[model samples]
Target: MELHALLSYTFFLLFLFVIAGETVWANEEDRKVANGGFRPTKLFVFGDSYSDTGNNPKSLASSWKTPYGVTFPGKPAGRYSDGRILTDYVARFMGIKSPLPYQWKKYGENKLQYGINFACGGTGVFDTGNMQPNMSTQIGFLEGLIKQTVYTKRDLDSSLALVTVSGNDYGAYTASGGPEQGLPSFISRVVNQMGINLKRIHDMGVRKVVVTALQPVGCLPKQTIFSSYQQCNETDNSAATLHNQLLQQAVTTLNNSTKGSSFLVLDLFSSFNTVLKNKGDFTGSLKFDTPLKPCCVGKKGDANCGSLDENGKALYTVCNEPGSTFFWDSLHPSEAGWRAVYLTLRSSLNQIYN
Candidate 1:
């Protein structure tokens, strides 16, 4: 009878242990799936303000102003949005905190476990409006680090890269008085060079490289302001359509040429348009009631979202809640906008998994 009792108690303990183990296993599988696969150990970012996370200096760039990081860190965080930007979400998808910016490398030199962010605001694939390093120079920064043995070949093996060449180049072209007739040809040049940059990153041993399609420029508040921010100019959207079409073809050709077509495209064009129009085939609630209007606006035509008066007072007006608004400024999306955009890219992001 004593032995029977002991055996019964032992079996009950074993049952409990089995249940606990199963629970842990299930949780891990859920985590892996949520992360889209094996979580990448590192992430590298490149391109314009959409991906830039404090890479630009406060002395030059406007990203480090008030109301930018108000929604996230409760202070200015050098991001273009009211909080985190697309790169932050991409890093989060990798199950890692946003990598430190390239400009502040020395501050946390020992914390390269995740990766580095070399993107700068207002920069583009080729030299654009900003004086900051161009896309090639940004890649050069990574190469220099690798050459210095900061990131080993093994590290690059498990790394992921996000490249966001937003419409800064187009803005540059337009600002420089490049003819509207020449726009299509110039877009081809930009995309062709972007394709080369993508291939180069892949060749450098990155496991995956995801590049974003340019969002609808004409739909931005800056463009729609003329219509009292009520409508998007069809002509501008048509130009965006042309860009996306070429980008899709370029990506398809790139994949066809590469073995795994290791380069992937993030369809921001469709996502932005969907959110702007409040209609999409996605599952999430992309119901933006006022997508054309920004959360913050400049008092004067020359001022911007976080602009300041000479008296040091804010020269811009902020919305009651930034999350409710789409654009943080004339160009970048609000943090909430980025969150919705991330959801829209869910189907494409699944390709990141092993």
Candidate 2:
């Protein structure tokens, strides 16, 4: 009887252990499902310089000049930053290579399997002064490719699209003599158009679409320069705040109306603010001791990072340690800066799979 009872107790404990192990496994799977087990096979990028890899014409843009891509590819490779941009980091997290730029599509046939980048530097939701294709035109390019069956429905079903506006439209508005009082109205127009663009991309059958909320334009080195790189311009920051609030409302409407939640905002405004506020304290191994100052600047009036004199003499000043600074130029973040931003965005990016 003692042996029998002992054997029964042993079996009962074994049974309990098996059940508990299975429960743990099931819970792990549920976690994965909630976090989005569906991985994207392709990544489509659309935006301005913030996402542009090499879409801009080499001869016409500063991105293709010396000291731009000096950190990563070791030479000018059309990225506006010292290294990779937001798109590259996002693709890496997705376990895919950064998609080829639309203009460079012909160079490699196999690369098309990953995706294509339609972003152009100095371009915006609306046509800016650069004369690059507007957002509407960029979308039309994808539509044309779909028509050609370059990407079948199967391809789009497993794909992701990234759309970034990044304040170029507002820049254009202010530059073209848009009145200060009318700024809020212009911001509305931009976001409304962006909503249409997002829906169009979704209707084209892409599985997931991620768009960026406008970053703090006031915190950029250009605006901060007025404060001797000590503080951001609160007036411009207020406008960015309004833009993000409107964008969030639009995204909420999109998700509620759709069958599934396919549209998401990257919240670049918050990410930038967080990184700037922390000043590399949270970003491991990367320090931005002087977060507001740019690594490169014009040596003289109006000369940009890659500007040259009539005699072809370089007219820009580059920092000795680009990795230590946040902004690479007055306008864009360095690779280190993007890395810090990416860290903050990882949690948000996971929603793509969900």
Candidate 3:
């Protein structure tokens, strides 16, 4: 082989080695977490699809279909990704198994040690087009448990709460023919309601609450499809900026009013954009071949993430390797993408429990 081809072959070999070894390295990280003596022993989760772990009804949700959980656990586990969603990793960081999904929590009474996940996919801060419970209702589930004394005052004092609201309300707004001119006002309303939700949860006695800033909705494959997934829409990103700005103010005010630093905002927009700009720089162990394109896509533009055919065959095409893709579908990230973003948010996660 020529000199350049020889180097290309060498890099190819190393990439394969990393691919083979990545699973073992991930397992080792989990084992270390098991013995790491983390402070928070429990985690309570709320909000929409990003943090939802099987809370959406499997029979009606596409997330329970094939290939959704093809990576982690080797089967569909109702997470909105190929493998673990944000809930799983956040729980793992705190040295606990992910809390049971709200729809199934009652069945596993003994599994509430890590707190419960009340998040439902495709739902939002307010009631969206779907019938799934909104943010306040999600919190109501936790409050009901508290009222029944399922979690004593000590559990509430020792627990951490995670809140995620990924742009589903805006999506619903557009879908419902709500005009573009009205978006800013609607975003403000969303944040105000979210602030109320945060305060209500805090009042209910959760020790610490973490609210995630909106992810760059423009950067998602749904919006990127207009650019062939090659470029992001800056106008949409600007909207996200405004949303985060107001959210930061709200969170700051909440923390100032509460005892200690009771509220923190996870800067998902900044960290997600950073990951796109400098892929895998923190770990240097994995590389995404196409950061914008999804790992799984329908043959046509209209199909959902894990769509299937009448014959039970896959109607969508999957990339050769999901572990190298940042997105799994039009809306959600692959397991690898969440892992990368978690690594970027390591400092923020540390700030919450410590």
Candidate 3 lDDT for residue 177: 98
Candidate RMSDs in order: 10.3, 10.9, 8.8
Q: What lDDT does the true structure give each of the candidates?
A: 0.77, 0.83, 0.80
TM-score of each: 0.87, 0.89, 0.88
Query: Of the pair 1 and 2, which is ahead by lDDT?
Result: 2
lDDT of model 2 at position 66? 88
Tens digits of per-residue lDDT for model 3, 1-354: 001111111111111111211232233233232123225667889998899888898887878988788987778878888988788777766656778887885644566876888999999998897899999999999989998889989889888999998998888888899899999999999999999999999999898899999998899998898888889989989989899999989998998898777888888897788777776436776677678889888887587767877888778888889989888898898888888888777656655633
Q: How good is model 1 by TM-score?
A: 0.87
Clashes of each: 0, 0, 0
| Range of the 10 consecutive residues with the lowest summed lDDT in candidate 3 | 1-10
Candidate 2 vs candidate 3, TM-score winner: 2
Clashing pairs in 2: none
Instruction: Tell me the lDDT of candidate 3.
Output: 0.80
- TM-score-sorted candidate list, best first: 2, 3, 1
Q: Against the correct fold, how does model 3 do in TM-score?
A: 0.88
In model 2, state the lDDT of residue 215. Answer: 91
